[model samples]
Target chain A: MENQEEHQAEGVGRPGRPGRPGSNPEAVTARIRARFGDASVRDGNAVGCESVIAERDALLPFMTFLRDDPELTFDYLADVTAVDRLKLDEAVRFAVVYQLYSYKHNRRFSVSIPVPEADPRIQSVVSVWPGANWLEREVYDMYGIVFEGHPDLRRILMPDDFGSYPLRKDYPLHGKGERDNFVF
Target chain B: MGLEDQLQENVMTTKVDAMVGWARKNSLWPMPFGTACCAIELMATLASRFDLARFGAEAIRFSPRQSDLLVVSGRVSIKMMPVLKKIYDQMPEPKWVISMGACASSGGVFNTYTLVQGVDQYIPVDVYIPGCPPRPENVIQALMKIQEKVAQAKAN
Candidate 1:
């Protein structure tokens, strides 16, 4: 018990370890590039945070590597969400974002997968991180993006019978009469 | 020949309807279907600060069968409307509903798709207290109004 408390106290105030490779964004990006080739990873630092865009086909394997690798053990999947870029006139319609954190190194990294409007499907990372279950469901719920191998992918926030994804820019602000059609 | 004049000194004479109404109005048990910010105001009304017991409505019942009045004190979302309707249907007859804020009455400022426009679209409302979250004083006034309605209900 005393040893556990000392370790927790060390975690609370200690700075990033001097020799940890995953403590910086460049090392994370370089590690991904070395494994999956330069074409599979791209710098996506437009949002002022260290982020990388990964190809949809390579997502599951890349995520597994980020978790299982000794130097880059991104063990925590903080959140899974999506951004609909329809109004921005971007070529890709949606980008599914994953916020990953490594408890061992106390570092956070972001990964995004661009999905086209016509085929908005990606491999589920639930096998790599079980906590992505509900988060992936929420992304599917709001953006209408399909996670191919998710165990139970269904609407998490919206009603089960809800027709359209409200977060999409093409959807109206006041809704399309869903609120008025109740039996009671 | 008046019935009260013919009775003994301690005896009383009144119609059954009026007597029942008086009893119901004096001891109203409220079911607080609180879902949002307005619920805080409802709690304030029931707590010692405002003392809702003075009006004889302090007995808060969670079960629909035991309550005489239902106080819907927040925004009802599209997903939550069916559950709210089921609760309303379960309530015993001769019940009253108090729409206790702008949200419950008319969706307040939330004109979005998820939120229900008004709870009255699902259940019959007896009184609507119109404020973002009506003050505890306003809640007390609405309770008094419900009591007045109970007292004035005509016999079948």
Candidate 2:
């Protein structure tokens, strides 16, 4: 117990200790809205936890600000993924979701950006978080969402020659002959 | 007459085919291609309590070239089909394959896209042990069945 106390005092083991200096999710969302203006941040709400919807064009800059701002310091990109909503009658068919965590504040939040079906393109968040590389690739591989400006983006899970995105709402549950053709 | 008769019976003989069959049936080195839960059961069969060594098949060689029996004990996915076929092809002739589980035998409950419907679709299987994960004794029974097949095989 003494050794643990010494480590905590030095800030070596527990960076995400509750008393550390950082803003809560609500403060982070308000700051983003203030800096980027109302046009950039479409909506902000607390559904189970705080979630912010950002415009597709302002995504990269907004993410950069969130990481660089000392008060926010959302330094950890927990996950990068996408949801396919083909069944819903909405203008945008895909929503790219980013889960972020602040090590200093011990808080977590989500950011979602909707992308249209015809042009399912979104700016990659690899610049802010290097760990977004494979996560973004997985999203692309599963949902067929194109992440612009991403280096070395390709299929991360499925076979390179896999015909269609299997996670889409339109894809058949059992598959459409992809598993049978490869004999060798 | 015991000592006198035993001493006189010095030139006993047997058929060549029977001797060959006995030899082949006794020494079957198994290559365990274990990939899932069934692998644990296979290990139990090889352990001291179950004693697979008694059947002369405890020599678990990993290399396909050195092994005579291929015991595939898990679900085979579509991605793994080519690799499995290649290994089966590399094995020498007079080899036998045992598809040992519900998954390998008929794809079990994973009737989906990723897994192969059955291993027998790509490779010929001699014995199909039926269980989610067959017990160690059931594995031994399968071995005995294989031995019967070896004994009955015509001499080449």
Candidate 3:
């Protein structure tokens, strides 16, 4: 126990430790709304967590601000994924989600961008977070969402020759005969 | 008349086919193509507790050319099917295949687009052992069945 206390004392002010400076959900939402205007950002209905829905056009700039700002230093890009809301019958067909973590504050934030089915394209955040390369590629492979300006964008999980995105709502539970047509 | 009746004193004789079959059945080098949980059971069978060496099949060879029996034990996905076929093709002739476990034999419960329904669609299987992951005893029984087949083949 003495060793643990000594370790904690030595580890103070480092990333991931408790009792460091942090930002609340309301503060984060207010800052984003102030910068992007109330029309571009709004509070999301995510229970027990901080989530904000940003317009497709404002995603790149918003992500940059969230990372570069001193108070909201969301430096870590935890994950990039998408949801197919076909059954929900929402105005937008897909919602690309980004999970971010601020090491200074040791808090988490979620940002989502609604994408229409006709275009199905969004600005790539790889410039701000280089780790989004594979995560964006995975989203593209599964949900067929195109990430503009992403380097070396290609299928990451499925085979290279696979035709359709399997995670799409329209895709059948069983594959469309891809498994049966092997050359061997 | 038996060959013993025709043989002279202090001499022994037997058919060449019977001798070859007996030799092949006694010493089977198995190449394990294990890919999932079934592989754990396969390891148990090879360890001292089950001791697969008792059946003269403990010479587990990694090289396809050096082995005669291919024990495919686990799920085979669509992406892995081509690779599995290549391995099976590399094995020399007079080879036999034992598809161990439900997944290897009939794709088990994973009836998905990614997983192959059965490996036999690509390769000829001589024996199919049932069970999600067959017990070590089941593997021994399958080995005995393969030996029976080998001994009876061309012995008439």
Candidate 4:
């Protein structure tokens, strides 16, 4: 499908999306600014606006709006990944990445939320995106990030009895002391 | 057909048989369900230096339909056992399988809960190339053995 047709197909998309009568990137920018205002918005080179490096409280609402928004039409959540930011700044220690695909607009947006180390609780978007079930389980297994409403959250890649979160920054990379050593 | 008909056809009377026969004779395609590092050596055997294309086995088809041989390389995991069975089931009849490397031939070093001890636990293996990781020359020799097996079957 053509790019613009996708968003219109979603419902009524923002003016910034292609082929919309009044849509422009600036207009979408205005709509975004109007919703969460100046403080919540930050730009990233990799993805688009709606990038909302959202706070923990802001996650569920923003995700809900993105799902319900006719103009933005971010109907599909493609992937969710966790990045442990322990050394970068303890202020917000982990990044929960949500990749949203707009079927109507043939466009994509990524929503990142930063969770501080003290209280690493974030709402599960599984209610919003069915596919987030496995993705959230992976994040929970690897980063130990607590998803508040996940029904069947458990360790995935590693064994159930495995003690620690392996992907976290502090987890030793030596791989359980099995490394081969060569004589100097 | 009958054994008498098969014996007479083994005689090369046509020019087409010599040219195409050389290809059908030497070029035996290998399809490996490589689940680990031993797969790298399998690729090396078909690379430019070894040049398995000369023997007409270089075309590595991913699907079982066109493949003449199945090379079960590396350690087969338990989760992967069903997938291997599915792939093996998809292959045309009269297919041969080579159990390449110790992992596929036996269990090799990864004697863990997840890995299947050997591919032969699920499917018949025609030749077993026993090594931590066999060299390309060993792969070529293994192929020659399969070819001899094919020739013997034709005689029978």
Ranking by lDDT: 1, 3, 2, 4
RMSD per candidate (Å) reads: 4.7, 5.6, 5.2, 11.1
Q: Rate the local accuracy (lDDT) of all candidates.
A: 0.86, 0.82, 0.86, 0.73
TM-score of chain B of 2: 0.91
DockQ of each: 0.73, 0.45, 0.63, 0.05
lDDT-best of 2 and 4: 2
Residue A23, model 3: lDDT of 29
Off by over 4 Å in 1: A1-23, A46-48
Give the lowest summed-lDDT range of ten residues in model 1 chain A.
A10-19
lDDT of 4 at A18: 42
Ranking of predictions according to DockQ: 1, 3, 2, 4
Once fitted onto the true fold, the runs of candidate 3 whose alpha carbons sit more than 4 angstroms away are A1-23, B1-12, B154-156
Chain B alone, TM-score, model 4: 0.82
Clashes of each: 0, 0, 0, 13
Model 1, span B38-148: residue lDDT tens: 999999999999999999999999999898799999999999998888888889878999998999999999999889999998889999999988999999999889988
- Over A101-143, each residue of candidate 3 has an lDDT whose tens digit, in order, gives 8876676788989999999999999999999999999999999
Q: Kindly report the root-mean-square deviation of model 3 from the true structure over all alpha carbons.
A: 5.2
lDDT by residue for model 2 (B1-156), tens: 566467676765566777777898899989888988999999999999999999999999999988888999998877787878888888887889899999999989887667787899889999999998999999999999999888877667
Give residue B144's error in model 4 in angstroms: 10
Compare the candidates by TM-score and give the number of the best one: 1
